[model samples]
Target chain A: MDEKQFRDYLSSYTDAEKALSAPMRDTIRINTLKIPKKEFMGVSGLKMEPTFYENGFYADAGPGVRLGATWEYFLGYMHTQTLSSMAPALVLNPGERDIVLDAAASPGSKTSHMSMLMNNKGAILANDVNWERGSALFSNIARLGVLNAKVTVRDATRLGINAYFTKALVDAPCSSLSQPYAYKKFTPNLSYEISKTQIKMLFSSYDALAEGGELVYSTCTYEKGENEEAIKLLLEKRGSASLQPLGVEFPHEPGLSEYGKEFRKVARVYPQHFSSEGFFIAKLKKGSA
Target chain B: MSHVTTFREYLQRQFGAEVPKEIVLNEQEGVIRAYSKTLMMLKPSGYMGFVAGKVSTRGIEVKSEFAQLLRNPSRNVLALDEAQAKAFVESESVAIAEQGEGLRIAKFGRHVLGVGILKAGSLHPDFIGKGRKRVENSINP
Candidate 1:
């Protein structure tokens, strides 16, 4: 692989490299399932500024407050998550009546967020392929008071539940190159290799999705193969898959547009744009071919 | 439904709450759990659900997992001030005046901390939570 060419892709966006190493404030979301927003804020006794996302705030814990060890956290009143990571679920927008599939849910930040979005009224099939990670997923799910999810431990690509989910989320694990010094952990050789497995997860997400159902494919990496090209391949093989505009009103650039291909509907959030990690999000609809 | 009937009778008799009509209650090996009824249609695995309580000859002993779900119960509650609540989570037992025979839900102000035992007016914390690791009970940013 042309490692230099792959690294050069960041030149397409402003401050992409600078954004990579930016330090960000601790951001947390009030778990409204456990406590109301206003009530949480009142009891938190910490100074906080609201972020762009709903029920999210950029928190300043001051001197002694360990957000993780606090009674509020233990009681499932709040969760720590990045602003960029929170967008995919907001765009997916699983409602109170939707049967959603969180295809790669673990440590369950998105799954718990989806439950909060649903007001804990809908069903979520939260699955992760690894048993080890699945335990952490349930821990978060339990800690957040998420009663609407059915946790499953299985190979996501082998999941053959067809047309059962009204909406599905595939927050596929990537090289995490968006983080500062993350490239040292994952070499460039793994870019396409990782996307290969990502495509399988996508196929499973598409399969489980009901026709005309919304699918949100997201990754924290900026690899084109994992980002745009994989979706391009999916549209080619599965003729019913079509990209839809992601309705996130945040600081982000549109998906890479090159050659004669048009990927204008997809969105890429640069870390510098929002002082959060980089993310690539695409909204798609599954339909009958 | 006779699913965990004893647990059901215990909840109603103790908290004056019916475990919410929308929740599905299940018991296995004497431990009662609760989950969203709609999600169970998927026949989910790892539905350990929330560990509401365990059933025995004395009826049900509430688990800390069910503390937040209860608003306020009419009977069998052990109230603690902020200082005692902090000390209790660290596996400390506080002396008391009222002689309750068994366990009661421990509360700090409006927040329900977990289950505690009251024997001969000595309140013992039976917490199954982060405090088990000797956590710094401060609210960190």
Candidate 2:
């Protein structure tokens, strides 16, 4: 809302490097299993670093680099995914034969990564609402040599409640507030007007996930109103689901109580802390087995 | 399932030929299972969805789309216009060669999807595993 509140809003973040400059574009993960590290270097001719936690290579999208049309990418060997974006899939740990759904998968970075991690052994339904976006998702999945994936064009909120999945990933569409370039008016105070759609899609994700199934809800935004508060409300509607803790060593900022009890297990990554975009993640296990 | 038969009939009328009886049409799931000496999976639009990931003594593991096509290859070839049929046949030939025999062909249909040289005359199906060196013909053929 204001600079003071913005400072206080991020006060809990331990690595509040208030002086740091914002990055122009986010990092991307190159699928190294198909394109080996050595070959990736040769093709992009760019220095690459692997994220410590996942099998993805990160490159700065700053200077004269066209990542999409390159040979490595056209062959379906790489996806532009953020480091923190990889966390929820790891948290979900979907297995082969398990039915997985990615509710908001467009330009499919995490969806392709999950398919490979599953070793192309399970069914992954990657759904996106927009026709153009869904087509883009399908193209990326095809380029990756994925055989066990299916694409659907539908409003994720309308994916029937009758369906069940071993695991679900809802990278819900949220306010891009955490992006440094977001207009000042996008803050949580404006949540009433802008966040309504996100709130609806998030609940729809929970409805689509089956009993005893696990859903990892994630958003790139850092605000409690969108992340923790949404989880808290969803937990209230579906009491059977509860939050699970993250094992990765990440910093926990203080005074974020606006999200209530559910915030304890939720994980947040700040731009200052992870050298990446701000992200919020929470893992919820559905009905007990 | 009736959608498959209706679609098959419509195709037969359009092409003026008897559709193959073994075609298993599944329009509801948006997939088709076609069975012959080999299995083919097909989508409603007659596109090959997948090929058999495995070969079996009993039945082949047809992909979702080709499994639908195997039952009525004629209806499929006829489903497209002469130009499209020719293109489909060429593309399918390449896909089948590459997938079933590990032979990459430079052209499929009118467009070229890759630059694989055709194997010397009468390329043995046995040469399929040559794409990967570690694979040896240890299994009795």
Candidate 3:
């Protein structure tokens, strides 16, 4: 999808066009497990504002200071992540005692976040299919002082685990349409193929979830085929799962209701509207057998 | 494997730090690793594939990747000031004010950057590893 083509598809062409070229804000989330938020904020030369999430902040990175290179980051006291990417973990809200599964965790931004949320108390099965990325996941997990997580190299759709998890996070792989340069490579066939894999991953995630468990499915794409349609297919195939409303307060539009009433309960974030990257998130609950 | 006792004895002789009872050390392909007992459960389920650290021929050396998991360090510690810490993290050796040392933890403020070595009254930051360059650049800048 070219800029013109994408603009024509948007609800407001002018705002969307402007947002596509807008500068992305630098945001960081304080790792409370490592350092207190107040003390980290006291570091000199940092000017920031509270993000939608309490632990996150939108900061003006000083000249020549790479946020990733800071001492605080080295200590794993903070993580450089986009505000939109931080939502899925916030929504999942894993507890200290819950056994959780990060079905497609790699490079471990969300997995580490879940670890902090869990206070490194329970077990987290962090899996990624790619070996190279799995190494990065392990490194990040270790750097962040995350002990409860176990790194695994396996396709999430075929994870042969005998035990069920109380909660799961599926930030499924999707077409990178939300990225500024992604539209150049966008194709109908590619989108269709990704949607199919996404649907399969969703089913697998639901299968691994224990009864009364909650799963948060999210993606960084604006394509309905890969977002709502995939969830609709999962609901149709799995009789034991249902979609639930997300009660968290964040800037977002309702998911396309044309798909279904339950789909409307899902949240859609557009870069133009939220001043962040495009994203879709839906909360799911596995009913008792 | 066969070197488990040797490795334990090495740690005791060199650093005077006891290998904790809860830490299970396993050797694979000539590399020894230390892991918590809980990791055993994940190993049986095939959920964990990576080891925490490696024990070298010299002594039980912790891999940089798992350095954060080391709750206790050998008494040899050198605290660096902001300037010295930045210089040390840039992979540059910096002069230390307080004398004597061997393997020391390089700390900047409250954050532990990793391990460093002190020889000839100068601290070598090679232990910061390749991954920690980002921290050096950001904090030092």
A-chain TM-score of every model: 0.93, 0.84, 0.94
Ranking by lDDT: 1, 3, 2
**What lDDT score belongs to each candidate, Candidate 1 first?**
0.77, 0.54, 0.73
lDDT tens digits, residue span A154-260, model 1 = 78877878888889999998988787667666655788788889999999889888888999999998878888887888889988898887876877878876822
Per-residue lDDT, model 3, residue A215, is: 94
Q: Which stretches of candidate 2 lie over 4 Å from their true place?
A: A1-16, A19-26, A32-45, A60-63, A185-190, A249-255, A258-262, B1-141
TM per prediction: 0.89, 0.64, 0.86
lDDT of 2 by residue, B31-57 (tens): 442222111211112212122223334
Per-model RMSD to reference = 3.3, 11.9, 3.6
Candidate with maximal DockQ: 1
Which lDDT tens digits does candidate 2 get at residues A159-207? 6655366778988877766766463656556765445666677777777
- Give per-residue CA lDDT, model 3, range A122-165, as digits (tens): 66888888888877786677667676677777788776653388
Choose 1 or 3, whichever is better by DockQ.
Answer: 1
Deviation in angstroms for A48 in model 3?
1.2
> Evaluated on chain B only, what are the TM-scores of all the candidate structures, in order?
0.79, 0.26, 0.61
Best by lDDT: 1
Rate residue A229 of model 1 by lDDT: 81
Docking class of 1: acceptable
